[model samples]
Target: MSIPAIDLMTTLRSGHSTSPRLTWYGPDSERVELSGRVLDNWVAKTSNLLQDELDAEPGMRLGLALPAHWKSVIWALAAWQLGMETVLDGGDADYLVTDRPDSSGRHDAVIAVALPALAMRWPGELPAGSIDYASEVRSHGDVFMAHTDPSASVCAIRAHDGQQHLHEGLLTGFAAPHEDGVRLLVAAADGLEAALSNSLGAWSSGGSVLLAHPDVELTDKLLAAERIHGK
Candidate 1:
């Protein structure tokens, strides 16, 4: 019998819920770990907020103007869950999400994000129409129901060094190696492509990812300490 098709959110919510799914290392050796269940909960809340509060639909375009942080990862997964397209360049978006203090964009909706894990708010007044993401997303439920088909386009990224197109189908087909429990170590220098690819691959293969901020140097000793098996 053929298996039913599943989106990224479904994939995340299934399987070992308590297994470690993401490990992030920031400047000053700050480390944060998230289990599969925790990550799924965050994704669900973000998705609910996007679909319910923001009126985001499958074809909507969202601008992601943040660095390779864990929150950014959550936002990407939420966008995929809503079947929305994520534009890394922040071009012509229906909504724009950023951690930058000075919000500058042409998006209809703006969300100012605070990168700190414990930050409960965006701090101070933002642009007139902008809102604090951390504060708003918490009120959302811990589950999501997709409004579009899983086969529909979820995201689009620049391909061939911005010379071609990398559609959702092709991205979905980029499977990871069958090796179980693969823990990938990611660097900010790898850019969005590496971040998304590694994230997707790890989740698809029932593995996890470890991300390091640009300010932190990843050494062999650190890799050994973190038990990072791949990059």
Candidate 2:
């Protein structure tokens, strides 16, 4: 059976490969934009790193102990594409992706992610056993091929509230509603779950998302510059 998340990515890649799919406005006057093809490339590389290096597979639990940033979004998408279950809470997991390496000792594997767009590697030394995501991810393949296909009924996400969402209903049941082709603005302050839900809704409808960091003021000029249609 085809995974809904992977299918959505395929549609995004084929439909408008050059159009901006995700735009990020972060602290320190940082701005990053990713077109559909570029977004897929990042997801593919991350998926490859998870699947090949960490032996990730369907049914494996991948915990994300990170905030609602672009890197976190990519990690979720990568986990889904590899058929791994994404744990939003600090639950038990086979692998944990986090910015804080100190608290990730319990997981079997740890991936330390850097939030800066231009970071070539983690700023400081990570935990002895943790992998540096920014450093290693770039070396992986730009395309990913899953070793096994996941069933539609397989668990896709484990929410912070302990609700389990299946692959078949991930987007249909959880995504926030928006009009077709709506350029939605997602506030990172709303949390990771909301970011994922809104992004799914926007992309699934041939739309795009603009993610603003908590510190970035949502000014009228910024909204106009980004052509935001809804929040």
Pull out the clashing pairs in model 1: none
Report the Cα lDDT for candidate 2. Answer: 0.89
Pairs of residues clashing in candidate 2: none
Lowest-scoring 10 consecutive residues by lDDT in candidate 2? 99-108
Error of 2 at 174 (Å): 1.8
Model 2 lDDT per residue over 1-231, tens place: 688889988987889699999999999999999999999999999999998999888889999989999999999999988778898878789999998887436888999998899999999878789999989999999888898887778899966676788988888976778789989999999999999999999998899999999999888888999997445
Error of 2 at 63 (Å): 0.5
Please write out the lDDT profile of model 1 over residues 15-92, one tens digit for every residue. 847877888888776888888888989988988888888888876787888988898988877876666767787567
TM-score of 2: 0.97
* TM, every model: 0.85, 0.97
Q: How close is candidate 1 to the true structure, as a TM-score?
A: 0.85
What residue runs in model 1 are displaced by over 4 Å at the alpha carbon? 1-6, 101-105, 147-155, 163-179, 219-221, 229-231
